[model samples]
Target: MPRQLLTDELWEKLKIIMLKMGIYDKPCLRKTVEGIFYRLRVGCPWRDLPTAFGNWNAVYKRFNDWSRKEKLMGIFNALVVDPDLEWEFIDGSIVKAHQHNSGAACEQETAIGKSVAGNTSKIHMAVDACGLPIHFSVTGGEVHDCKEAPKLVAELPKGDYIVADRGYDSEALRLQIKDKGAVPVIPRKKNSTRGNDEMDWCLYKYRHLVENVFARLKHFRAIATRYDKLKRNFEGSIALACGLLWLPM
Candidate 1:
């Protein structure tokens, strides 16, 4: 059974968007997308996806191509209104790197550090109040959360509030956020040279929204377990999951 997250009318509208975006041309595109979403919803591996939908490789390939092209970002951007555009949260989560996700010869270029878990990847995401992701970056798990703050904040709209944990407290990150006309709401570190930074405990409490987004994203087993061998494909799955998050309830 097709677990319908979209109504028939909405599905038709989505198909039109895909057609206009040239995503409907591939004979297997629809089936591939369906199968991928099925796996996401059911928390199954690509190869474990039911064969009735189509070849797992084909679906994975399409997903990778779209992700590289930023099609998923476009699709997600088109679906949701940018609410609280000035309020965003920054957070990082460590994913246990599966052997299947290894063997990327190119990853050496981006490998910065390793986590206590040994082989792992860190996903840094910036999300709006609606729990919609605005920007994301990946790095070695050992990378400091504060190191990616600048990059993540760079993608946010100007003059926004970026809420983060003490891990993101740093003079460089604060200046970067200020350069972008955004407020840095990171709590002060215990051993910091400067005294406690100004914090909005009330608004900071809402920082958990980004954590909730991470929780929802990890709900997809592939994301949690990471069966995709390619980093691009894994990122694509994250974008696709974000698109699903935009669906009307």
Candidate 2:
């Protein structure tokens, strides 16, 4: 697929951000840095990086160095546009882990998790109405979506309306959400016999927005399948993808 280059204005903004983050101090040139980010945003393999950006090895080295320093996540967090409203959606999506992501094989116990698809990693995400990601967490696919709810919601600003699904239904989860001063709009499971609690079906429909956000995230093929061996790089790519999503299209 053909890729879009950053506009001059956006490129200038990126340069400013990189300079502030001390990424421009190295031997890496402007073209190299831009190429690295381009491949990241486009979700293409490093070897497939367009020649216009500069040597692919140079771009990949810069990317790896930045990943190690956690600079990418910093840039992402700094660039994210804050949500204009006080409502958010929370959900988790499973990404199949690739063999290449097994560099930390010794730490396999830490990275591998069970999912419906067998072994996979789970990404817990919370996004605002505009589909801007606010907070995220990673765990083994075996972990229940509801298990990641508290941590995801904890990062959200207090008093926001958090919409979820029936899978998130649980008294403890509801209490945690309420404790944060946010209303839990998750529907009750069918097996629930509780008569006092009720769900707003109208609000439930909007929960699909989170699903849409996941769909956009997976549009980046790199994120669709894990390639980065380290958990941090894997997660950094996610944050980068989120940053691109927040950018004005």
The lDDT of each candidate is: 0.74, 0.75
lDDT of 1 by residue, 131-151 (tens): 787778777788889877777
| Candidate 1 global CA lDDT score | 0.74
Which residue window of length 10 is worst by lDDT in model 1?
Answer: 104-113
Candidate 2: TM-score? 0.87
C-alpha TM-scores of all predictions: 0.87, 0.87
Pairs with steric clashes in candidate 2 = 114-141, 114-142
Q: Candidate 2, overall lDDT?
A: 0.75
The sequence of per-residue lDDT tens digits that candidate 2 reaches over residues 38-97 is 765666778889888877887787777887788878877777655744778889888888
Q: CA lDDT of 102 in candidate 2?
A: 65
Clashing pairs in 1: none
Cα lDDT, model 2, residue 23: 74
